[model samples]
Target: MSLHTASCRCGAIRFEARAEPFYASYCHCEDCRRASGSPVAAFVGFYTRDARFIGEAPGTYGAAPVTRSFCRTCGAPLSYVDARLPDQIFMMLGAMDAPEKYPPTVHGYVSEALPFFHIADGLPQMETSTVPRPKEDGQ
Candidate 1:
């Protein structure tokens, strides 16, 4: 099982989660853009059963259907949990020690992507928030 540990900038909050991720993507949704104050937000998903919080629990805010958690000391957005996906936790890639280890395989919410921002990475791009399915056996 793969394991990942991530922390806020000030190290006031940390997270440890094991097992493979359910999904990983770069989200261009407006909500995520506003939350991260960036053109896009990269995130990783893992089953809540294999995750644990260390140090102090971060402060949180209601971001519509989910609660966005962040470090009060450094104000870095760490994780966001959506009730719609109750079994998983979505964490910001930047908070991880080696964000490069989790390369995003898809891009979501392209409809909301800023016109000036273009991603030429060739990954699958979805117009909205659609969970991608794994490739099956040969046709």
Candidate 2:
């Protein structure tokens, strides 16, 4: 209902999201682990247009159709935008001012989740990679 603001660790990039995230998830894919240097990467997806970057544009790298933006100063992952999914943006959960407020609703790429990691009880789980489905022609 209310806007939430988030920023990179070095304060190089900042943004605001006008609504609560539609969904949150923890990704255990290898790419995520490599990028985040953690066992998993947590994200909160929002409507792309609802978010506005403040200050300098964060540096971005395209991984095919998807591009990830991060703070050039600190190398902290900030957000992710996929050309294939233009309507949404996934903000790195750690960047949030109140990270605890956006606990993951699901655990994705669970097949690759770390051997020692145990998913919590109630969150949904998906083994394969998942992306937002496109709307039907009629909307």
What's the TM-score of every candidate structure? Answer: 0.90, 0.89
lDDT of 2 at 105: 78
lDDT tens per residue, model 2, 1-139: 6888899998878999998788788999888888788989999988977889998789998677778889988888998887768889999999998999998878889999999988666878899656656555758
At residue 89, what lDDT does model 1 achieve? Answer: 90
In candidate 2, which residue ranges exceed 4 Å CA deviation? 134-139
Which residue segments of model 1 deviate by more than 4 Å? Answer: 132-139
lDDT of 1 by residue, 50-75 (tens): 99889998999985568999998999
Ten residues in sequence with the least summed lDDT for candidate 1 = 130-139
